[model samples]
Target: MLHPDLKAQPSRRLPEHGLAEAVALAAALPDLDVVGQDVVRVAKAVPATLFGSGKVEELAAALRAAEVDLVLVDGPVTPVQQRNLEKQWGVKLLDRTGLILEIFADRARTREGVLQVELAALSYQRTRLVRAWTHLERQRGGLGFVGGPGETQIEADRRAIDEQVVRLRRQLDKVVRTRELHRSARRKVPFPIVALVGYTNAGKSSLFNRLTGADVFAKDMLFATLDPTMRAVELPTGFRVILSDTVGFISELPTQLVAAFRATLEEVLEADLILHVRDIAHSETAEQAADVDDILTRLGVDKSVPMLEVWNKIDLLDPAARKSVEDRGAASEGIFPVSVWNEDGLTPLIEAITRHLDEERQHEDLVIPFADGRARAWLHEEGVVEQERVEEDGVHLAVSWTARQKGRFADI
Candidate 1:
C-alpha cells in the first residue's frame, strides 16, 4: 500500500493515518496478502505516472525485492498513471476507488447490495476503458467508415457496459421500490428509528448486537458490514425503536459508492435519531466523526433530526483516559461514553435515548368530531391516546405524541 502525500492537499485525515487506513482497506480483502506499505511523499503528481520516474523505479525495486503481487495506491491514480505504474512495478495496481469497490464487491451479501456494487463497478470500469485497448487506428470491417478497430472495440465495450448498467439500474430500482414499501410499512408501526453510523471498524455493529441481541457480521475489519441491518429494540422506558446498523463511512469514499448506496443510506434520513458512533480510542476519532458528518450532510440528513455522539471502545482506553472521556461526555449534550464489549455506561446511553425521545413528545387535548372515526382510530393505534371522553358534538381526547406522529395523524 502506498499513500501519496501530495503537497498542499486539503484532506480531513492526516497523511500518516490515511496511509494506515489504506493498509487496513487492503487487508480487508481476504485474497490479497499485504506484504509492504509506505507513505510516498509526492511534491507534485506526474500526470502520466503519478510519481516521478526515479521514485517509481525506487518503489519498483522495493516491490520486486518484497515479491509483492499487488500495489494498492492510497490515492487517486488516473488510468494512464495506473497503467504506467503497473508497467514500471511489474505488478497489478489498484487505486483508492478501485480498492474500495473490490472490498464492497467482496462484502456485499444481499441482492440489492450486489446490484449496487455491480453498478458502481461498471461505472468505475467505464472510466478506465481508455487504457484497456492498445490499438486506436487499426481498421475493422464495417458497413461504412465507422473508424478503426480500437474505436470499434471501445464503442462496443462501452455500449455493452451501458446496457449492463441499464439492466442493473432497473433491477436496483425494483429493489429500491420494495425497500421503500418496507419503510412505509415500518412507518405505520409507530416505532421510532435509530440509525447507527460511524467510521469503518468503529464498533457500530457490535453496539447494534449488544442492543438488539442479533448476531450480525461484526468484526475488527474495515467495511465489515456492507448491508444495512435492522432489529426492533425496546428501550428501558418501554418505547420501542427500530435500531438500524448501516455501512460505515470512510475518508475519500468513492463517489460511485456514495451515489450507489444512497438508497441504503435512506434509512439514516428516515431515522428519528442517529447515533454517531466513534472509536474513541483511535487517534483520528475526531477526523472520522467529521467524515461521517460530512457524508450525512451530503446525504441531506435533516438537521432537525436529533443526533447523539457515541464514544465507543472505552474498554481499550486506560482508566484515567476513560474517566476523562466520560467526564467530557457528561459535560456535553448528546454525548455518551461506553464500551460495547464491556457493556459499560450503556444504561446512561439508553436513558439518553429515552430522554431524547420523550423530550420530543408533546401532550395535547384534541376534539375530534364524532364522524371522524379514522383519526380517533389512528390515535388509538399509535398508542398515544391517554384518555377519551364522549361528547354531544365531538369526542374529546388527551394524547401524547411526537411532532412526527402528530404530522402523520394530521395527514390521516
Candidate 2:
C-alpha cells in the first residue's frame, strides 16, 4: 500500500498514520497480505501517474522485488492515472475508494446492506469504464463517437449498468420502506433511541456489547460491524431506551457510500441521544472526532439533538493520564471517561445517559374532548398518564410525556 503525501495538500493525519490506517483497512479483508507499505512523498502529483517518474520507477523496483500482486493507493487515483500506474508497475491497483468498497462488500451481511454496497460499487465502477475498456476507436457502424466500436460497446455496457442500478435502487427502496415501518413501530412504542457513533475501530461495538449484553460481532478491526444493531436496555433509573450500534465512520468516506448508506444511518438522525465514542488512547483521536462530527453534519443531524462524548479505552492510558481523564470527566457536563474492557466508570455514564434521556420528558395537563376517545386511549396506552378525571365536557389528565410523544398526540 502507498500513501501519497503531497506537499501542496493539507491533511488531518500524518502520512505515516494514514499509511497505518490503510494497512489496517487492508487487514480487514481476509486472504489479503500486505507485503510492503510506505509513505511516498511527492512534491506535486503527476497527472499521468500520480507520482514523479523517478519515484514511480523506484517503487516499481521495490514492488517487483517483493513480487507484490496488488498495489493499494491510499488516495484518489483518476482513471488515466490508475491505468498508467498499473501498466508501469505491472500490478493490479486499487485506490482508497475501491479498497473501502471491497471491505464493505465483504462485511455486509444484511440484505439492505448488501444492496447498498452493490449500488455504491456500481456507481463507482460506472465512472471508470475508460480504464476497463480501452478499444475506444473500434468502428462498428455509423459516424463519429456514437458509431465507433469503443463508444458503442461502452454505451451498451453503461446502459446495462444503468439498468442494474435502477433495479438495485428499486430493491433498496423496498428495504428502506420496511425499515421505515420498523422505525414507525418503534416510535409508537415511545422508547427513546440512543445511537453509538464513532470512527472505525474506536471500540463502539465493544462498548455496545458491554452495555446491552448482545453478542454482536465486536472485533479489533476496521469496519467490524456494518449493519446497525439495536437492543433495548433498562437504565439504572428503570428508564428503557433502544441502544443502536451503527456502522463506524471514517475519514474521507467515499461520497458514493455516504449517499448509499443514508438510509442505514437514519437511525442516527432519529436518535434522541448520540454517544460520540472516541478511542481516547489513539494519537489521532481529535482528528478522528472532527471527521465523525463532519460526517454527522453532512448527514443532517440536528443541532438540537443531545450528544455526549464517551472517552473510551481509558484502560489503555497510563495511570496519571487515566486519572486526568477521570477528573476532566467529573468536571465536564456531557463527557464521560470509561474503560469498557474492565467496566470501570460505566455506572456514572449510565446515570448520565439516564438523566439526559429523562430530561426529554415534560409534564402537561390535557383535556380530551368527549369525541376524542382515540386520543385519550393513546395517552393511556402510552402509560404516560399520571392522573385522570372525567369532567362534564371531557376527560382531563396530567401526563408526563416526551416532546416526540406530544407531537404524536397532537397528530392523533
Candidate 3:
C-alpha cells in the first residue's frame, strides 16, 4: 500500500508525479500478495505514535473486517510502538522493514541467503523482545504433554526462544564459514568481480541475466532476487569477469537487515567494479541514486573506486526521457543508458564496464626462466596475461593484475 507520506500537501502541493512513483514501487512487490492496505495520514506534528487513536481504531476495525493476517506499515515503526500497535489491533503489524524482511525470507533460496534472513530476523526480534512476551503474565500450564510438571507459559516460551536464537546463530556461523571457503575458491581463480547494485525494481537482475546469460529469477517485484547470483561473462576484449547480482537497496532500509546481509554485501566491498544500474524512467531516479549511494557510503567502500552507471529500463521511458537520459545528463564520464528487456543501448554500457576494468587493473611485463615452467604456467592460469612469447630460456608476457596477484608473480 502507498503511504500517506507520498501524498502531495494540497495547498503546498507537490507534483502528482510522486504518486505514480509510489505505485510503481508497490507494483514491484507482486509476490507480497499484500492483501489489506491502509493509508494513515498523520498531521504536520505527527505524534510519536505515528498513527493517532482514531486512525488506530479505524485500522483495527478494517483489519477485523478484512481478516488480514498481516498489517504492513509503509514507514518505520519503533519497537515499542510496533508491540503496542500489535496488542491494540490484535493482529501482526509489520513496518516497511518487517515487510522487506518477510520478502527476503520468502525469496531466499540459497544457504547464504537463508542465513542472512535468519540473522536479520533475530536482530529485529531482539529489539522488540520487550513487547512480544508480555502476554505471558498469566502463566497457566495444564497440558498433558509435560506430565503435570508444566512450567509457566511465559518462562517456557522465553527459554524456547533463547534456545532457538542460540541454535540459529551457531548454524549461521557455520554458513558464514562455508561462504568464506567459497570466497577462497573464487580468489584462487581470481577473476575481477563486478557487482550490480541499485534500488529495487530497477532491473538489476535483468541486467545481470542479460550480461552473463545466466537465467536468475528476475521479476518486477521488490526484493525479487534475494540470493546473490554470480556468473562469468566475457567482455569484447576476452576479459572474463564475475558479475554478481545482489539484493536491491531501498530508502530507509532496516538496520537489522543491513547487519543480517553484511556478509552477502561483501561482494560490493570486495568488487573490482560496480554497475550502478538505475530505473532511469522512474520519476524518483535522483532520490533512488541517493539511497544507493547512502548504503554504499555506510558499507565503507572506497568512494574513489571506479563505477559505471548503467541507467536501465529505457523502454519504459518516453522519447523525451530517452533523450534526456542520453543527452541532458552530460554530468559524468561513465554514465550510459540501456533497456535490458529489449536489449536496447547496451553497447555503451558494456564498453564503459570494460573501460573501468582496464583503468583499475595494474599492468606489468614479466619474464620467467625456462627452468621455472611451473611459475610460468601458474602465472598464465591465475593472472590476466595479455600476451606471451616463448623464448629460448624463458617465457615473456604482459600481465595486468591486482596487488596480491602481482606479489604472487613476483615471488615466482
TM-score of each: 0.86, 0.86, 0.76
Better of 1 and 3 by lDDT: 1
**Higher-ranked by lDDT: 1 or 2:** 2
lDDT of 2 by residue, 1-412 (tens): 9999988997988999999999999999999999888999989989999999999999999999999999999999988899998999999999999999999999999999999999999999898877454664343464564445344666766767889999999999999999889988987767889999999999999999999999999999999999999999977544579999999999999999999999999999999999999999999999999999999999999999999999999999999999999999999988899988999888988988988887467889988899988988888777788999999979999998777778778776
Ordered from best to worst TM-score, the candidate numbers read 2, 1, 3
**1 against 3, candidate with superior TM-score:** 1
Clashing residue pairs for model 1: none
**Each candidate: what lDDT?**
0.89, 0.91, 0.75
The runs of at least 3 residues in candidate 3 whose Cα sits more than 4 Å from the true structure, single-residue gaps closed, are: 2-38, 44-49, 60-69, 83-90, 131-134, 138-162, 329-331, 359-412
- Which tens-of-lDDT digit does each residue in 179-278 have in candidate 3? 7898899888577899999998899999988898889888876777888888888787655689999999987788888877888888899999988989
Candidate 1 C-alpha lDDT tens digits along 166-231: 999999999999998998898775677899999999999999999999999999999999999999
* Candidate 3 lDDT score at position 135: 68
Q: Output the number of the lDDT-best candidate.
A: 2
When 2 and 3 are scored with lDDT, the better candidate is 2
